[model samples]
Target: MAEPSPPSFPPGNYDLSSVDLDDDRYEVKQSAIRNKYTIRDSTGNVVLRGKQKMFKMKEEFPFVTDNGEDAFTVKAGGIMDVTGNYAITDTGTSEEVIILGEDFSLFVENWTIRDPDTGEALATIQSKSGFSRPSDTLSPL
Candidate 1:
């Protein structure tokens, strides 16, 4: 028999391949102090969990699979990096898979997702409106 899932993750056989290819809609939840975040699929199942320290000059978010295995790590730009970009590193390969660059804006945050190795743009995650951050990871999917 297999070991039971951890309390941090929901119970089920989480397939990362399914999450990467099939899933189109995912709800992202964040903690109030801006330290942790959880991503859920359209079926309202927790797919990924990420956390970082509450206070840091440069933040680093270590993400894990639903089964609590290492998945990826997102490191924020250093103090000298004016763009305030974030690099997503694949834990297994130890390579930067994606780069999220914060575009300067007067009112909202605009992020560009890029291919880290090739330096090619992939997609963009723009803040449509002011996000009313929740304290916990409980929201409608």
Candidate 2:
């Protein structure tokens, strides 16, 4: 008789392809100090987590997994960067993948998402004007 095979395991352990691209919704939980954030999928499964140290001159958020594996890192612009841009870097290569920056607009909140590698504009988020209040100025998708 042939020997029994070991139990099969899930493919792509912590691989990028293993991530569910279809699941867009994420449930977020933040610490009381707003320095730590826990992110979970819509099914209540922990997927990503982030932590930031307090009282830092420049903001840095290191996103990781529950088991303490580096996922990605986000470094915010210092006081000199007036546009309020943040760079998202890959954990392994430490290369900038995306550049997030805000656009200066009067009476509207505008944001621009770009690819740092190719310098291509990926998307733009613009808040509609005349919402009566700033809190409700977000434009519906």
- Quick one: best lDDT, which candidate? 1
Task: Name the lDDT of candidate 1.
Answer: 0.64
**What are the lDDT scores of the predictions, listed in order?**
0.64, 0.61
Q: Per-residue lDDT for 22-98 in model 1, tens only?
A: 46666776665656889888899888898876555566768887888888888877743435678887787676766
Candidate 1 is scored at a TM of: 0.69
Stretch of 10 with least lDDT, candidate 1: 132-141
Clash pairs, model 2 backbone = none
Tens-digit lDDT track of model 2 for 37-85:
7888878988888877755556677888666778778787773343477
- Go through the candidates in order and give the clash count of each: 0, 0
RMSD values, in order shown: 11.1, 12.1
Error of 1 at 35 (Å): 2.5
